[model samples]
Target: MSDVSTRVDIALLGIRGGSTPVHRRSGAGPSDDGHVLIGGFGAALPIRSDSPYSLAGNKLLLDGADIGMEIEPIGRPKFYDLQTADGVSYEKIAKLHGSNVLATTVVQTCIRYGEDERCRFCSIEASLAAGSTIAVKRPDQLAEVAEAAVRLDGVTQLVMTTGTSAAKDRGARHLARCVRAVKAVVPQLPIQVQCEPPGDLATISELREAGADAIGIHVESLDDDVRRQWMPGKATVPMSEYRAAWAEAVRVFGRNQVSTYLLVGLGEDPDELASGAAELIDMGVYPFVVPFRPLGGTLAVDVDHASAPNRDVLEDVTRRVAKELQHAGMLGSDQRAGCAACGACSVLSSAGG
Candidate 1:
């Protein structure tokens, strides 16, 4: 195997081994403050499930150790038990993320899925496979879920991300419709929408006009080689296309309101990742630096993939980027909605937001 792949595999094995219950402990102390800490990383664990070996474990590791920060997981929303008139569970439609953001995948299945084009890091269909959610959520269902998550869970924002559809718009139209429906119910709620850069840039205006508060057009990696290896199908779309889409998103969403995901440990050099982040920030976008987690059932898991940049690397990159964001006066607080604002999945929010 190549050097980068070998490094990533080792990292993945370490993470899996470290997350075992025997090796885990609650990060309890005066500093705990309801947050869970593991392996020098800290984040709020979900109140509903105390099992420390799941995604929450990985999140805590990334937060406390990687970013030198602490974040609290979002508690169970009151809407989890509620069902729509048609008998759809609200929680399955849209679940709360972080402290006050409701997130959902409108279309669980992607056209690129099962094809060689699938992004290796993604397990968009796994939730569906485990029966955690329905294959597709109707616009009305999402609006209903959002309303309850806000009223009961104290959710203040919403994030709608969709699997790619057959259309070139890549399900942006459905996302726009969902955003509109949810906003109609809660006009003051901040809503963020995420999707691939569509074949038509006009869909961006459609989303903004539909009342979305912000947008995330994630190009997980700017390094073409890493992109091809990590997200084969998505990498087919040129970086120039992503740049144009980001420019238009910033134009519509305004400054930091536009964001993208930049996963560390994808074989991209640390300096290169930081420099790419700088370019994105310079363009009025937030580069959300996240440590790659190999979700169950993803191609990553099948290949036993892992992230190479450890906590030290993550901290260095986040600190530098946070400093840049501060200089630009672009706190995640300035964002109306989305992961950057929730700040739970990544420690960058705690680093400086």
Candidate 2:
């Protein structure tokens, strides 16, 4: 076996950098300490005190020995130092993701965050609770912060996700409002709008018409059992709704422009997960396969003591899904903008998926 540890290998095993300057201490689902750029691309790795991999002055190390890859941590953006006209910090509005994408939760509070109803792996409101973010980000606030982020940090894209709202649009209409405001200020910046499917399918078209370049209708897992177990509240939305949303999103945003998250550590069988990813690819949806990292404030960590997936399984599924993406000519980089395009939280891009 090669001693030069693969980037994905390091990502799975994680790194012991207790002093990491740019770690995200709290956030929503998917990942935290989210931006470690290896080979000039973003990677999501855990911050473990006992990890085999460590970062030493931009050099990657395995078991205290230096490897050749240059892994750079994305620092706090310049815009974070500034505040809005009403005196809210710019960071509370949106945060830097990867090297070039600005990300935020437009509506930080979730209707599904009740103890019995919440997604086991989510902590969408943790940042809000910690006073690092606001309950709602207004359209003007988003536009102002976006313009500054791009002008100051050279950000190339924006990703806006919202907690599921009680309303019929499920926050899509609000996403459109924020998107339109940002587009009015920065027409050249590609924007990706993410939300649960609305009760009305027409809002999918409204998002595209509002200057959104891409959309992520994330269902996380296609397996109904997995959905039911991991996402009790969201699972109630029915697979039929997700299917309708994906179809409508594909119709509106076009192929390779639509994506979804498929977490590898959710206990879905590796072969089966890849099989599901292949199906998504066939349907013109990019399956973003990322390993689940346990985060503070999530039920998985606080209640179940869930560790990340077995690394072998993570790698196996990634390669399998990447092959399918290759066969379909659907590269994450092909998308105009979104999680797939930034690809910090998933290994699919590293696997060349």
Candidate 3:
């Protein structure tokens, strides 16, 4: 299949999850990275199989018809079986995302988890309730687990994301500590840290100094009205704050090193989303456009608003944003670390962005 068609297929798979898909039994959650190697590229896609597609052996079937493609789900890594010296399981602390990237929710609880304040699509705390992950992961524990992952799994990078803490730094401080500890143990491992835009832009520099190679200051949406509807609490931060944070992060982490997630399936207009992506590219921020999966624990799933965007809508928005990325010479692969670089959750890379 061509790149556009492949991207379209991937987008559809995310919307309508395939059945009997290959994946490891033990990995990250409440939102796990269901890695499936698709097409001939061995491109690892992070899928949440909640939709109508399925697999028969290696062939991918969409709505029971052959997709005319082969896919293989990634198996759980050996490192998950190991435990820390203190007896905490490695898998509880962090899990492999995609094929080789170790990822963790450094702090699983968010301040905005309340009904009126929470992002409708977020499942950060749900994993904790499910006993799939711990509430707080110490810096030292993260360092220890990361070393094991690198040594045992040949893991190339790290993604450390945290829910918004009560502190004004929005958990950047804790993320920095975790990054420092991990970098100290494995100096060559590239690390990506994710958090909300800090109240003090200076924290961006602190994260860089602490050894984070890339940063994800995810806004999820650029349309303020949509933000208010889907993320009432986060929307209060305002677009200006996000812009300032992006500018500061770009200044500290350098051009393509800063990325943000712009979820496409929300109610944002396609033209507006694409335009926002263009503006983000101009600011040296990579807009990681992702299909909005209706995770089971999210408010969207409960309200019956979890439908994925139409195929045409997904493809149009992605192609437009990909064009912007290409024109700006901002390939997601250039990040070297983080969600944008992973390319499993989004098809912009396949679209030649």
| Cα lDDT, model 2, residue 35 | 71
RMSD of each candidate?
A: 7.8, 1.5, 2.8
User: In model 2, how large is the Cα lDDT of residue 259?
Assistant: 92
Top model number, TM-score: 2
Report how far off residue 63 is in candidate 3 (Å).
4.8
lDDT value, candidate 1, whole model: 0.71
Per-residue lDDT of candidate 2, residues 214-294 (tens digit)? 999888888888888889999999989988898889988999999989888888877788898898899899998878877
List TM-score per model, in order.
0.81, 0.97, 0.92
Model 3 ranges with Cα > 4 A deviation: 1-3, 13-33, 39-52, 63-66
Q: What residue pairs are clashing in model 3?
A: 18-53, 18-54, 19-53, 19-54, 22-73
Model 1, which residues run further than 4 Å from truth?
Answer: 1-74
Worst 10 residues of 3 by lDDT: 20-29
lDDT order of candidates, top first: 2, 3, 1
CA lDDT scores, all candidates in order: 0.71, 0.86, 0.81
Top candidate (lDDT): 2
